[model samples]
Target: MKAKMEHKEKKIKKVWRNMNIGFKSDLHEI
Candidate 1:
């Protein structure tokens, strides 16, 4: 169970990072 939770946390972090990058690019287009 612990391992599963850790894997999910990593996935969430990766997705959040991608979202942050996209957000930055969008801001630059303004």
Candidate 2:
């Protein structure tokens, strides 16, 4: 169970990082 939770947390962090990068690029486009 602990391992499963850690995997989920890592996936969430990766998604969040991608979102942050996308947001930065959008801002730069303006």
Candidate 3:
């Protein structure tokens, strides 16, 4: 159970990082 939660957190972290990069790039382009 603990391992499953850690796996989910890692997936979420990767998604969040990608979103942050996209947002920053869009702002810079504007």
Q: What is the lDDT of residue 15 in candidate 3?
A: 100
> If scored against the real structure, what TM-score would every candidate get?
0.96, 0.97, 0.93
Local accuracy of candidate 2 as per-residue lDDT tens digits, 1-30: 999999999999999999999999999999
Best by TM-score: 2
Task: Put down candidate 3 lDDT per residue, 1-30, tens digits, no spaces.
Answer: 999999999999999999999999999999
* TM-score, prediction 2: 0.97
Task: Provide the clashing-pair count of each candidate structure.
Answer: 0, 0, 0
Give lDDT: candidate 3, residue 30: 100
Weakest ten-residue segment in model 1 by summed lDDT: 1-10
lDDT of 1 by residue, 1-30 (tens): 999999999999999999999999999999
How high is the CA lDDT of each candidate model?
Answer: 1.00, 1.00, 1.00
Q: Where is the poorest 10-residue window by lDDT in model 2?
A: 1-10
How many angstroms is residue 1 displaced in model 2 relative to the true structure, after the best TM-score fit? Answer: 0.2
Candidate 2 RMSD to the real structure: 0.2
Q: Which stretches of candidate 2 lie above 4 Å from their native place?
A: none
